[model samples]
Target: MAQAYDPYTNVIHTMTKAMEIGHIDQSMFEILKNPQRETKVYLPIEMDDGSVRVFEGYRVQHSNIRGPFKGGIRYHQTCDLNEVKALATWMTLKCAVADIPYGGAKGGIQVDPGTLSERELRRLTRRYTFAIAPIIGADTDIPAPDVNTNPQTMAWVLDTYSQLKGHPCPGVVTGKPVELGGSRGRNSATGRGVVISAKLLLALEGKTLEGTTVAIQGMGNVGANAARIFYHRKAKVIAISDVSGGLYCEEGLDIDAISLYLNQGGKLLKDYGAPGVTHITNEEVLTCKCDVLVPAALENQITEANAGKLQCGCIVEAANGPTTEGADDVLEKRGITLIPDIFANSGGVIVSYFEWVQNIQELTWERDQVNEMLEKLMSKSFQELLNVTEECHCNFRMAAYIVALRKLVFAEKMKGIFP
Candidate 1:
């Protein structure tokens, strides 16, 4: 049997390795290793069936030294406090690496949204929001959407918080609908950022986006949009998958058609029949022959069990902690260029920062402006991470951790301990 996965342990492992490699101060390591605050709440919601179900939720503020705590709120059955803690810590590192003026925080409710109707989901979200409202705010901590949540979910959060304050407080949340003050490019920012990172990494090897074979695991917002963007960029999206299964074609799958099918609420790739499209299992999609493999599905998708089987030339983590430490060792031994999640999939938060700015300033920028700003931030950070990797003789993941940890620790030292 495979070893039990602990997301928080993976995070601390990476942090300790990066600190040792960077030769940072031990005291700083002690301070930067844990979240500043973690709150758990019980929300009792009245379901449409007239039954009362109490749900467990959490909000972890990893750090706020740079600015307000910034991260997304995920709703999934598997969302536990440890996972939230790890994600919150990653948010902090992601912001620092992206050079965004925000700290790191994460919130989640332990419930399978698929099991709840739209009405129940909304009620649960609202109740959970009210429960954690005291700790979250525009200038204190801002929550966006993550995993199973979307713009609509964010709207619910914004509305719930606003209702409590008895005023229109749009800044209380980001990733909301456009009419509600969401940034123009916020929807596809994470996917766009994934493609941007891939392009940057390829350019370093005298390559271009065109003619590259890519396989993305996960068909949600991040994975689907990433597949579409890469398809538009002339890359051969050989394989793609959802929770059900995957589809593959050596010559490249019709990304446009596949996207349309998925957008229509299609579930499994087995039902997505198209000419030349071959049915492939999720495992096959992960280990498929491709130039780039994007695991955007969930944490621990790529583990020691199959890490050595990954055939892609490069692995860009679109999901949080998709690859385990042991798996990372295998990839390093295999010389597969792996881009860390903190930097690779930060486009969403980067744009979320823009949305927060717009909400605070009560001003909205054009899509072109948002997209342009996003590219600059992602590309610049990519280059810096590349430099750190080369300078420290470490993998991209370690390099990113070193960069983020250094910034966070420096801030921690300057801030010092309160009396």
Candidate 2:
């Protein structure tokens, strides 16, 4: 049985397994299991239709033992405390794996952003910011972009928080417009990190990105950016999907043209047509013929139903919780290497950390410099994860969790429980 997909449960189950395998002290399990705090707010937005609607929102701070809390804010209709908690916990594990000086937290609002006009969306974002204002700051919890949110969203958050502070407070958020103190590489950091992780995994087997076949699900920021980068790196992206639909090309689609077509706005995969491209279902994108499959979409996309049917040699999770526990077992038994999301998608947070540093210091870094630093950090973390995987004699996901749990539990031990 696949077991029902509850992201929080899946995270805890994996964390507990990693803790047991890594020989971590069980006494600190409670702290890691429970979020430090969960904040829920009702955002009342005055709709453009001269009506008022209240949306539910949440911010889950999973841990701050390593440093201050940090994570992304997602505006999704399905956003809930459990999902946000899982995401926040992954943020903690991700930072620990990357050895970044930050903890984990996630914020989200339960609203279909597509239903709102731009003016309404802006108003909703600002109101959400105001509701969560007291607990967030430069030195406190910082939010970045996530699903259905972007640099413009962060700009709204930054502007709102700065208004409350009576000064420019760029550090209050990340992934803002570059003109508003956002890092140069922040936009594509997650996808870039995913590609970098894939390259590292391939290097261990004497493989390279050149000519590697890849199929990616969810052509959002993460998936689209990863597909473009992989295409530029000489890898053939055979399949790509978005909320609208999917497209496949046996001879490899023209990524540059597709990206350009979509970048113009008001376009979707169903609307994107060209030579050598064929329309396919999103599910088909997951099980397509390819050497690498990147699931950059929402959680539980790779459940047991399709886990056994995956045809890829490796899966670099560009989205959080893309693979479930049951799917992990399925892939492991199939001899497929699954690069966990925390390790694979740490780039955005890494750049987010850089953005925070730049904001606090009032300095900006060049694009090349940011990209170079991101690759270095990702490479170092990949090496550590490989070491842990070998030592634990387990899967990559468990090994990554082990590395993170060890660091988190050690920090908790050294600090001890508060009085």
Candidate 3:
């Protein structure tokens, strides 16, 4: 029988492989594998019907050796401690790969946010914030928006934290509304970063986005933004999907129209109708023939079962842990170049860092400036990955992991244990 997928185990396996391939010191491996702290809080909120419901929430601080813990808060029904731990670990690697001065932490509430009213959700957010307040702050740890969470969620978190601290504390969170000290270009940073990664990868193959065909799985913030950017760059966004399912068009999807439809609150691609658009299952989106297949949805979307069947020449993982370790082996054997999520989706954190800087220094940057700096940093990081790839003679995923693990291990070595 096949074993159930555990994202935490998958990450550890990948890290081990990277360390082995790069000949990194193994003394700190065990330390890197375990989080420094894990907090699980039970949030009891009064629903709209006046019934109290207890929801489980988690906050896993993976590491803070390099700097403060930084990650996102995702509201997902399947969210659990192990999942949060995996995400937090990924954030540590991501920040290291991006060369940012931040560690990794992740928090999530196990609840389907769609079933909650706005008031109920806000109350839940406040309760969770109050529970984790002691460990999180502008200088200690910061949280942002992740799956099923958005700018409004971050705003609520910021408000709750500020009220608790008895002052306005905008830097306590990132991905908040621009009015609340959130950096410009943060909302779409991840998707933009995905596009930039695709462009860079394509450039290596002597191609460009002008006529490239792309299929993106997931139509959330990351995927939707990438679809729009790819469309504007003259790429044929042939397929896209959400939780509702996927839509395909051989002649290229009308991303602008699709985005508009999805933006009008409570929309799903399955109900969408357009000329030459055909509804397909999410699996089809993964195996669709395209130059670039971006699994921007969630973890384990591309596993060994489907990895061998993928038709794309390359994959740019915009979602953290979207591809499993077993699938990675298949893809590598098939010569499918995959740009790891750690570096590809670092845009959000990069801009989050910018937002944090602006909030701490009482300054604001123009949107263009933020975006230009994001591209510059990603480009530079990509070069670093290439260098590591050449040095280790490994695939991009291994190369990225090597780059991150080396930095993390070095930080641990320098910051040795203290009493």
lDDT scores in order = 0.92, 0.93, 0.96
Query: By summed lDDT, which 10 consecutive residues of candidate 1 come out lowest?
Result: 261-270
Writing each residue's lDDT as its tens digit, candidate 3 over 118-157 gives 9999999999999999999999999999999999999999
Model 3, CA-based lDDT: 0.96
Report the poorest 10 consecutive residues by lDDT, candidate 2.
1-10
Clashing pairs for predicted structure model 2, backbone only = none
Candidate 2: residue 36 lDDT (0-100): 93
Task: Give model 2's clash tally.
Answer: 0
Name the 10 consecutive residues with the lowest summed lDDT in model 3: 410-419
Count of clashing residue pairs in every prediction: 0, 0, 0
Which runs in model 3 stand beyond 4 Å of their true positions? none
The alpha-carbon deviation from the true structure for residue 393 of candidate 1, after best TM-score superposition, in angstroms, is: 1.0
**Candidate 1 error regions (>4 Å):** none
